[model samples]
Target: MSLLQEADRNHLINEFQALTEPVKLVMFTQEMECQYCRETRMISEEVAELSDKISVEVYDFVRDQEIVEHYNIDKIPAIAIVRGGQKPKDYGIRFYGIPSGYEFSSLIENIMMVSRGESGLSAETKAWAANLQEPVHLQVFVTPTCPYCPQAVIMAHQLAMESEFITADMVEAIEFPQLSNKYQVHGVPRTVINESTHMEGAAPEPILLGKLQEAVA
Candidate 1:
C-alpha cells in the first residue's frame, strides 16, 4: 500500500503549493540492522512526491562513506535539508531518528522553513542569530500534533541557517522517550541548547534568542 493515502496526498500538495523555492531532502540509510532506516526513507520520499518544489535524494550510508563523513552523520535514517545547490548555512536539522508521531509536523514545518526562508524569530532574535560567534547546538523534542512545537524548532533551525555556528534538530518524542525522560521533557517543544540549558513550550522570538545568546555566551 502507498504510505500516503490519496486524500492525504492531495492535502499535502495543496499545503505545499505556496512553496516557491527548491528544498532538497537528503536521506542516508543502510539496508542492515538499522531499525527505522527503511521507514525514514519512505516518509521522506512520500512527502517529497507531494510537491514539485521538494525533492528527495537517497544515499547509501555504507557506500557513501564520504557523505557520512561530510555530513558528520553517525546514525541511520538521517535527513539533511538543503536549499538550492548549496548546503544551507543552518545545520540542516538532522533527523537522527525517524520523525514519526508528533515529529511528522516537524518535518513538514522544516520543509516550509527551507522553502519560504521564514522563521518564527523577531528582529532582535534575527540580529542575535546573525552575530553568533560560537557553535550552538539545539535539540528540540516534539510530537507530530503538538500545535506549539514548530515555533521552537523553526526558530532554532533559522538561527542555524543564518549563523555558521548553529545546528538544530527536532527529535521525535516517542522515538526517543528515554531522551525525554533524561531531559525531563514533560511537555512538547522542549528545547535544549548546547546540552546545558533547557526551555519548554513555545517561547517567543526574543526569549528564544536570549536563550541562544546565553548558550553561546
Candidate 2:
C-alpha cells in the first residue's frame, strides 16, 4: 500500500488549492547507496505534482559542491525550499532528515504557506513578524511515534515558510542521537531556537514566536 491513502491524497489536493506564488523543493542526495534519500526525492516530487505553483528539483550532493556550500548543507539527503529557484540559494530553508509520518503534513503546509506569502498569525503577531531583523534558526527535535511532536514541527516549519529570516528544521531525534545529546533532547517536541533557547512540547504559535524573538534579542 502507498504511504498516503485515497482519502489522504484527496485531502492534500484540496489543501493545495490555497497556494498562490511559486515554490521549489530542492532535493540533495548521492547517486549510490543512500538510504531514505530516494524516498525523500519521491515524496517531494509527488507533492509538487499536486500543485502547479510548486516544483521539485533534485541535485546530487556529491556533484553539486558549490550549491552544497552555498546552502551550508553539511549532510546528504537534505531538502531545501527556495522561493523559485532550480538551484537553492544562500537563504533557503533546509530539512536535514526525512519528513515522514506526521511531519509529512507539516512539509506540505509549509509549501502552501510560503507560496501564499501569508501566515496564520493574528494582527499582533503579524506586527512582530514584520519587525524581525535578524536570522532565527529553529530546530525542532522529534520522534515519529510522539503524538504531539507534529504540532511543534508544523509550527516551526510554518514560521520558516512565512519569514525569510527564519529557518526551521524538524530533526528526527532517533536518527540523530548526537544532536539529541548535544541539545539534551530527553523529550519529544523539544524545540531549540538558535542553539540557546529550548522549549518542550507543542507550544502555541504566539508563545513560540515570542521565544524566537527573545532568542534573537
Candidate 3:
C-alpha cells in the first residue's frame, strides 16, 4: 500500500516540478529493533519517485557506523536533506522520525529550501547567521499530529541552512519517549537550543533568531 494518498502524491509532483536543483535525502535505519525504520525508508523511497530531481541514499544505522558517526546521528529513522547529485552540501537539517502528519509538510519545505539554495530568512537574520563563528545546535521537539510543529521545524532548518555553525533537528516526540522526557517536552513545538535555552512554540523569525542568538551568547 502507498503511504501517500493519490491527492497528496499529485500535489507533491506539482510542487517538485518547480525544483531548480536536485536534492538528496540521506536516511539512516537499521533492520533490528528500530520502530518505524521500515516505514520511514519506504516513505523516503516513495517521495523520491515523485521527482527525478530528488534521490535517496539509505544507510543502516548499525552497519553503517562510520557514515552514522559522520552525520552525528544519535538515533534511527533519521533523515538528512542536502543538495542533491555530486558535491552535495549538508545543510544540517534533519528529521529524526517519520515525517508523518503535519511534519510531512516540514519535509517538503526543507526540500524546497535545499533545492533552491535559499533560506528565505529575514535580512537581519541572514546577516546574523553569516557572522556566526561558534557552533549552535537546535532540536525542535514535535509530535506528528501537532499543527504548529512544522512552522517551528522549518524555521530552525532555515537557520541551519543559512549558518554553517548551526545544526537543526526535528525530533518526533512520541517515537522517542526517553529523549522527550530528557528535554521535558511537555508541549509540542518546544525548541531546545544548545541544551540550555528553549522556545515554547512556533515563534516568529525575529523571535526565533533571538533565541538562537541567546543560545550562543
Could you give me the TM-score of model 3 versus the true structure? 0.97
* Per-residue lDDT of model 2, residues 165-212, tens digit only: 877787878777789999999998999998999999999988887887
lDDT of 3 by residue, 113-161 (tens): 8999999989999999999999999999999999999999999999999
TM-score winner among the candidates?
3
For candidate 2, the lDDT comes to: 0.77
Q: In candidate 2, how many Å is residue 205 off?
A: 2.2
lDDT-better candidate, 1 vs 3 = 3
User: How many clashes (backbone N, Cα, C below 3 Å) per candidate?
Assistant: 6, 0, 0
Q: Candidate 1 on 1-217: residue-level lDDT in tens?
A: 5777889789889999988778989899885837778888999999988888888888888999998888777666789887754544334577767877656777788888788777656677667778777778888888777878777777777777676678888777767767889888888889999989989898987778778777777
Q: Give candidate 2's TM-score.
A: 0.85
Top lDDT model: 3
| Candidate 2 residue spans exceeding 4 A from truth | 1-7, 85-92
Question: TM-scores of all models?
Answer: 0.86, 0.85, 0.97
Clashing pairs in 3: none
Which ten contiguous residues of candidate 3 have the minimum total lDDT? 30-39
lDDT of each: 0.79, 0.77, 0.92
Candidate 3 ranges with C-alpha deviation above 4 Å: none
